[model samples]
Target: MEKVFNTRSMIFTLYGDYISHYGNVIWIGSLIRLLKEFGHNEQSVRAAISRMNKQGWVQSEKKGNKSYYSLTDRGRARMDEASKRIYKLESKAWDGIWRMLIYTIPEEKRHLRDELRQELIWSGFGLLSTSCWITPNPMEQQIHDLINKYDVASYVTFFQAKYEGMSDHHSLVNKCWDLDEINARYTQFIEEYSQEYKLDKQKIANGDMSDGSCFVKRSLLVHQYRKFLFIDPSLPKELLPGKWIGDAAADLFTDYYHILEKPATRFFESVFEN
Candidate 1:
């Protein structure tokens, strides 16, 4: 939910351009140009490049003050992981309707207005225009209930109809499900980190917490472990048997909140970015 120029996003932005152009070499100038297209300035782009190089995600060769970079195996892995997250964030199922609503609350109830708006966002509703929100679900009654509960019924109007069939909902679903490769990559990441950080599963299971040395390593491992339950938050608890799952799910949710719902919800938000 907090905006940051994460390594994942930077990998995707660069790899996306490479794939688009059918080329393997990405020059410094080209990286700058692509970042500019994504609304980033030169300094930010340079910082991302430096970070990537430092992390061994990419390798650069210099020729007369010009640099050309290519993805290392590690970079490819990161890009692969990012692609899967993007797919999960994008795919959805559609039951036809695109629900809409227009509400006008009393001026004095601005706090209520803000709360309702946040609720809608959490519920996968996107604003199509001021005072109007859209969702792929046909459950207008749920929206009505929210409005009434918030006491905005006095100034609200609701509408619902089938979205014109212009979107590829099935393609979106396929993308999300194409995460097996990403899952494999993450498993590899966990195994490597576990060895590097000397994470002892037996000790952790036996209640020994002293092995927690690398917080960054621990955090990255936990994040990847959580992707298994991204689409279904209520997955059987037996899938993850450790205190880390219990203690860290809440925090990791912040990083992965977008994919913590049904595929339909993901599809609607991706197709209709508010």
Candidate 2:
């Protein structure tokens, strides 16, 4: 299955994983080369950069002839919030309390409703019904901000309550999440990297891991793993099934990621003068 890839998303990944740590700045030429592996042409990458700049995600600066791109304050804040979800592994024990957020944005405000739905999902909520969303963790602040932003506080309700359904927790999990699909994706991730991890280890030990190769592989790994965010609710462990494959995938990713970091840094440094 060819998972969807967007030039825009890839650029974000590049900045978040690499440039964010270095100085939040990237050379245009280096960026084009980085995006080339994903089949994005320089024109398209340039367009993506321009779009990001217009959207307040990035700003461009010229130094002599070469140009550089860096995240704007707005973009950094956005990435910071997103990174919380991407790297967060829920740790607090589930209190068995489900926080429910219900909204009624009316027909004319359907756009607001749609936007709110996406925000809720991003905040780890699962839909119980069209009007109601639930999460095991309390997201009062997120919900409050969303409501205030949309000016729909009067049309929304937030409640902390226990489940009163007849179904078991397993049934609820199945209903809230597509565990089978998530497991399949995790299994795929595991299969792709577990064997590669061994070879990568050997390469590192033998000093055969090239800087460019490390950069490419690490980028692919990070980009691929990020797809999980679109599907994963990041549910707490207590709410997950026994032997969740995501746990294994996370472990493998962390292991391989650290191994590639040094070489990838070397590659990036060589490409970006500053």
Candidate 1 TM-score, C-alpha based: 0.33
Per-prediction TM-score to the true structure, in the order listed: 0.33, 0.86
Candidate 2 lDDT score at position 230: 75
Which candidate tops lDDT? 2
Off by over 4 Å in 1: 1-93, 138-141, 165-274
Q: Would you list the C-alpha lDDT of every candidate in the order shown?
A: 0.50, 0.83
Q: Give the per-residue lDDT digits (tens) of candidate 1, residues 1-274.
A: 1223454454445463233224445667766654443356777777877877886767888877888777876556545544443334223344565567788887788999898887675444656668777655444665766776677877888877754546564333232233344345445544454443333334344555332222222333334444443332221222222332322333333333222222323222232211
Best by TM-score: 2
- Candidate 2 lDDT tens digits, 101-192: 88877999898898888878777788888788888876777678778868998899999988877987667778777888989999999998
Locate the minimum summed-lDDT window of 10 residues in model 1: 232-241
Q: What is the C-alpha RMSD of each candidate to the true structure, in Å?
A: 19.1, 3.0
